[model samples]
Target: MSELSMGDALKLFLQKSRLKGSMQAMQITDIWAELMGKTIARYTDKIQILNRTLFIATSVAPLKNELLFQKEKIIQRVNEALGENLITEIVIR
Candidate 1:
C-alpha cells in the first residue's frame, strides 16, 4: 500500500468525519444565537442569521443605534466562538 501524503490525509479525514460543511454552518448559527443571547439577550426575538449575514430587528429605533455601536464587539465575539470570520455583515432594522 502506498503512503498517504499530508494533503490526502486531510482530505480523507474530512470525508470520513462528514463534517466539512454543514457542521460549520450549524456552528455559525449556534455561535450567532449564543452571542446574541449573551450580549443582547433582550433582542433575541429580533435576531436572525442568514448565510453569513446577521439581521436584528428592534422595536425601539434607538436600539438600532445601540446595535450599531456594538457591531465590532458582536463580530469579535462571534468570530471568537467560531474560530473564524463567519459573519460578513450585520443589518439592524
Candidate 2:
C-alpha cells in the first residue's frame, strides 16, 4: 500500500525477519567493548544474553563490584548503542 525507502525498508525487514533478536545479541559484545573501554574488556571473562538479561563473568572482584554499581547505566548505554531496549537486567559474576 505504501512505498518505503531503502534504509527504512531494510530496517523493517530486519525487524520483521526473526533474525533481529540474534543480530541484537551479537551486537552487545561489540557495543560493550566500545562503550566500556578496553580496561573492562580485559577483565571480562564472558558476556551472554539470556531472556533479555545480560550475564557477565569477570575475573576481578573489584571490577565486578564496580560494574554492579553501574548496572543501570550500562543497560542504558547498551540500549542507546543499539538504538533499542534489548537488555533488561545485568548479572555480574
Candidate 3:
C-alpha cells in the first residue's frame, strides 16, 4: 500500500465520485441568498454555474446595474464563502 497526500487523495475521490460540479453548484446556490441578503435574492430571477462562470438573471434593471457594479466584490465574497477559487466570472442577464 502507498500513502497519498490529502489533496491528491481528495482530488481522486472527487473525480471518481463525479460529484465535484454538482456539489460546488449546490454550495454556491445555497450561499448566494445568505451572502447577498434577502432583498437581493428576491430580485434574483435565477442563477446557475457553467464552465467556471456564474450566470445570474435579475428580475429588474436596477438590480442588474447594482450587481454589475459589485461583480468583483461579489465574486470575492463567494470564493471566500466556499474557501476555494471556483468562479472566474459572473454573467448577469
The prediction achieving the highest lDDT against the true structure is: 2
The candidate with the higher TM-score, 2 or 3, is: 2
Pick by TM-score: 1 or 3, better one: 3
Q: Rank by TM-score, descending?
A: 2, 3, 1
Q: Per-residue error at 66 for model 2, in Å?
A: 1.1
Give the per-residue lDDT digits (tens) of candidate 1, residues 23-92.
6556655665566665455554455556677666776667678889998888777667866776778888
lDDT of each: 0.68, 0.87, 0.87
Q: List the residue pairs that clash in candidate 3.
A: none
Q: How does residue 22 of candidate 2 score in lDDT? A: 74
lDDT of 3 by residue, 1-93 (tens): 899999999988986886887877888889888989999988897878777798899879988999999999988988898788888899999
* Pairwise TM-score winner, candidates 1 and 2: 2
Question: Which lDDT value does model 3 have at 88?
Answer: 85
Regions more than 4 Å wrong, model 2: none
How high is the lDDT of residue 16 in model 3? 82
**lDDT of prediction 1:** 0.68
Q: TM-score for candidate 2, please give it.
A: 0.83
List TM-scores for all candidates, in order.
0.55, 0.83, 0.81
Ranked by lDDT, top first: 2, 3, 1
